[model samples]
Target: MRPQCDPSCFVADHLKKVPPSGIRRFFDIVCEADDVISLGVGEPDYITPWHIRESCIHSIEQGETSYTSNYGLLELREQISELFSKKYNVEYNPESEVLVTTGVSEALDIAIRAIVNPGDEVIVVQPSYVAYVPSIIFAGGVPVTVSTKMSNNFKITPEELKNVITENTKAVVLNYPNNPTGATMDKADLEAIADVVVDNDLMVISDEVYDCLTYEGEHTCFSSLEGMRNRTILLNGFSKSYAMTGFRIAYALGDSEIINSMMLIHQYTMLCAPIVAQLGAMEALRNGNDELDKMIREYDRRRNLIVDGLNRIGLECFEPKGAFYAFPSIQSTGMTSSEFAENLLDDQKVVTIPGDVFGEAGQGFLRCSYAASKDEIQEALERIETFVNKT
Candidate 1:
């Protein structure tokens, strides 16, 4: 018999400490169940706008199947630069400040890895994207989780920010129009957090993946705030905004110095984002605004429908001003998020993720994405209503 070593012995120690994504369990269960009305996944049901898909097909027909430059195609970068300037009044140099990546997920990983040193504490606002905490850990950094309460509409307060800072702190991760809760921070809220960021002299990774899906007051780009652009690694993408989830193209914009360092890590790991995806992304940027607006309008309609429906059904749902999720408190249901979601899936064939999967503060809540079709959203609401009534 051949001598063998344990696989765990070869695995990176940091990764061994990180937990698997809590969101995926429901997704796998739904995939195996029949007649499931899934509001568990965060992806938009809309196909990549026809024009964007056609452009990708065109790129393939033209045999443009090569890898883009490690920094991504120059034209795509230039368009990204322009998009930021036009929408948020923030200027980034296409050549130096933008680093196109595989997705916002990849950009998040790269940002954490580039700046976080061993023993560094990265302050992470929760409940947020599942990747934030684990990514910090995987990069040899500790994640200091700060709970953004439902009482404040889940916005991260300046006081909360100040309390989490320490000498070991190196960066803060902000996601708004946030996940799970669908909360957004406006300029005033962001201005306050900016003060904390600047006073502490910490770097920030702002994930703005859902920036375009906002349904309330303006979505303030954190980098646009005073004294933030220099320290902010702004991450945005074509996935949620353009319904181009499969494209796997996103970009990070930041100080040239920081972007340069991220580029070094990116080039070695990813080599380059796919050329066809970049071309399609460029087309989406150039021509997809009208389509995006249409999608947002649909999401807005569903948002109102679901939020109202959940509240009517006895769940205490706060108004979600951005993104497409309705985080309804399940405390009144007399069950934990996991129990409520599991029973709903088993009895009603409706799938929604338990909110605690996002963070500890997410306990006693459930994240129901309205990014599904209007029919699906309406039906899911009805099923959820029935489940609530029976319980």
Candidate 2:
């Protein structure tokens, strides 16, 4: 029997234009293979440190399970305020300028929706996280992509940024210790870009989710820059730093007025981040730096191992200064990034994300995450070596 349906099928017009994420398609295939060693996922393999997890258990046992304030628990906000000041030299009033959301993911959505009007242009640097473009479009803004080259170590320059700016540009999205690339911006590089941003009066959405993972130098917060504090929305989370990805707790800090506006959107959309997750995040802010430092040290070791291993196997890889992923050029393989990734998964049972999944500019490269165990990383490297040699 044919299923009955509404004669007027309902779907938003934007839904037709929005494509499914390119990153997820490859991940789906990786999930079905039991023997696969996946270097494709972005999150760490480590469990959330015991102390942070125990805090949440304590909260529940104390019957602190009821809903907190819409903005989140005041104690958590106060903790975040102290941590930001101590670590990044940035100041925010927890009462008005800080907002706790479901994750950095939700904070990004709120910032975009609050700041962007329909048809406005938002500048995005690529290859970047998979979420930025779609989130911009969903807020009725057009995304203008600025491609960063491998020669430059994937760092976007002031000249490149200036070339893309125009009257319609509303915001510039910055991600340091970037996903997929592991590239970071130095203070001088940031100062150059800040000059342009301040001159143009553009808002900056700085995503520093991997701030604790930098290898070469300290991670500089854009909001900490001169004249940038009011105009920048800073996105960060417990997921990457505390190995609490499942907790889904993050926050946005910015000008009080801007944060208030975002809070309204957040209230309607998410109500509040999970109460347990917020408690866990608070504990992370209070006592998780040692855990973070330990993880960063491990990631640094794995980073060197993977980068050196790729070079030995004849793949030219950029030595990433931050984050856990390594982006390597696959030009010698005579295959596009997509083809190389698919064939590698099928032939070697090794999974990785194609750089082109990040953007067209990422075409001849692949991103391999070092967030796995040392043993798994070694095995994956051996398989990659064999695959390259045979091909």
Candidate 3:
């Protein structure tokens, strides 16, 4: 028998620098335990709309399982392009500028690798998604995080952006309606930030996966801003809005050069998103709006319930303008975010993600997803109140 090689030595150095996701750590525990009311996962509790699922099923029944083009099905890409044009007035040549990805996750990963060189500085807004920092690190880029305060309602200000700019800065990531915090920025707020990106000549990777979930005002697509069309790589998907997480369908829109570069990385790695998923996503864009609106309405209702419940329970939760998360300050409990989450799970059978898992700026908060059913949210809130009282 041949001697075994040490796995640690074979692992890439950049991969070694990244830590396991803090979001998944608690989720893994929740899976092992029963009778847990979980608000830890960011996924919607609802299933994909039947029409969307039916489309995938019909395609499978017809044996339409062949591998799609690396750019994904042209029909699907056209639908995606049209959706952007109709919704955000952002135009892209589906042939040259749209690259379908397995998920927004992959879209983000490829965007980083395409733009970043070793030691390139990528400014990440925190308490942002857990993947942003690691994606930068994996691409051998430095993640320079600018923390957004709760007092500012978690919106990154232009001064904050200017403070982080340096000669090494390559790009900035913008996610709003932001994950973990559920903050959404309006057009004026984004224009202020866009000015900085334009002046610095830096690329923008805008993650708008939760754009459809905005409750306060219309979502402003970052790429749609003046002077940002060519400078932005727009990433969005069906996971959050259309309830198609399992479909794994997403796309990126950008300058043709960047799209081509991203395709090179994606072709060699992912090859293409699944055909069934592409079909489902096409159906989503074509016929799923009514169903999506229904889900959004329910989410809006649940959002109100959870936010009100959290505040009534004495946890001062800021009103989440978008996405389905309620990020409430846990400082009142005199416990660290991790401790509060752990203790709540142990004592009250409720599951939440520690805010610091998203970033240091999230340290005194807890990210409680309101994506669950109304009953689940109510029960979780009750359990959290009980736990808080004891603490």
Candidate 4:
């Protein structure tokens, strides 16, 4: 046998630097358990709408199985263009400014890699999505954290934003109608942040995957604000809104030059997004509105149910107006987020993600997704009440 090199040596330094996702450990534990209710994954509980599925099935039956253009199907791109114009009041050249990615996840990755040079610092607002920091690190860039507090409902202020940005700073990643916290920025607030971005001469990668799911207020697209469209990379997808996560379809929109740059990396690496998924997404943009509205109403009902249930049970939950997560402060249990989640799963067989997985600032909280059925949410709340009371 040949000599074995040090195991660590085989991996890239950046790959070694980042830890595995904290969410996955609990997922493994969940898969091994019986009769467990999981409020863990950030996925919708609904099925993809039948019309959208039928569109894809029709395309396949017609033998439209070949690769699409590196950009994407023109019809899908035009639909996305019309949606942006109608909803966000933003204009995008469907032929030039839109790049259909494998998912919003891929759009984010390619955007970061395309913009960041070695030693550049990317400001990441936390406690945000788990992927942002590691993605920055993976791109040979530095991730500087700007922690938003519960007092501000997790909206990053211009002051907090200014503190972390340095001369080496290249970009900022924003997620609103945010994950975990369910925080949303009002239009005025987003405009204020837009001013900071303009003054700083910075580029922004705005992940609006959850934008359409807002409950209390409208989601002001970052690109819709003055001067923002030139600098903001708008990322969205069918995963959350249309309940089509399995489709693996999303897109990035920006200035044509930046879109071109991302396309270069994407073309060489991914070639094209899946044609079947593109067809499904086209139908989703055209016919999925009613189904989306129904799901949103249901999510709102369950969101109200669980948030009230948690507060009644003595765990403090802020009213979340966006996304379907209820992040309840578990501090009174006197356990770290991990300890609380672990013990609750073991003792009660109810699964929730420890908030600290998102960032260090998430330590005192737990993210309980309300994307499950109402019955499941009711049952999970009941078990959580039991666990909290006995503790």
Which one wins on lDDT?
3
Model 2: lDDT to the true structure: 0.92
lDDT for each candidate structure: 0.92, 0.92, 0.94, 0.93
Q: What is the lDDT of residue 21 in candidate 3?
A: 94
RMSD of 2: 1.6
For candidate 4, the TM-score is 0.98
Give the per-residue lDDT digits (tens) of candidate 1, residues 318-355. 99999989999999989999999999999899999998
The C-alpha stretches of model 2 lying farther than 4 A from their native spots are 1-9
Mind sharing the TM-score for model 2?
A: 0.97
Name every residue pair that clashes in candidate 1. none
Model 4: colliding residue pairs: none
Tell me how far the alpha carbon of residue 35 in candidate 2 is from the true structure, in angstroms, after superposition: 1.1
* Model 3, span 1-391: residue lDDT tens: 9998987898887888889998898889889999999999999998899988888889999999999999999998899889889999989999999999999999999999999999999999999999999999999999999999999999999999999999999999999999999999999999999999999999999999999999988999999999999999999999999988888889999999999999999999999999999999999888988988899899999999999999999999999999999999999989999999988888988989999999999999999998899999999998888888887
Clashing pairs in 3: none
Candidate 4 Cα errors over 4 Å, as ranges: none
| All candidates: CA RMSD (Å) | 1.0, 1.6, 1.1, 1.0
Model 3 has a clash total of 0
Residue-pair clashes per candidate, as listed?
0, 0, 0, 0
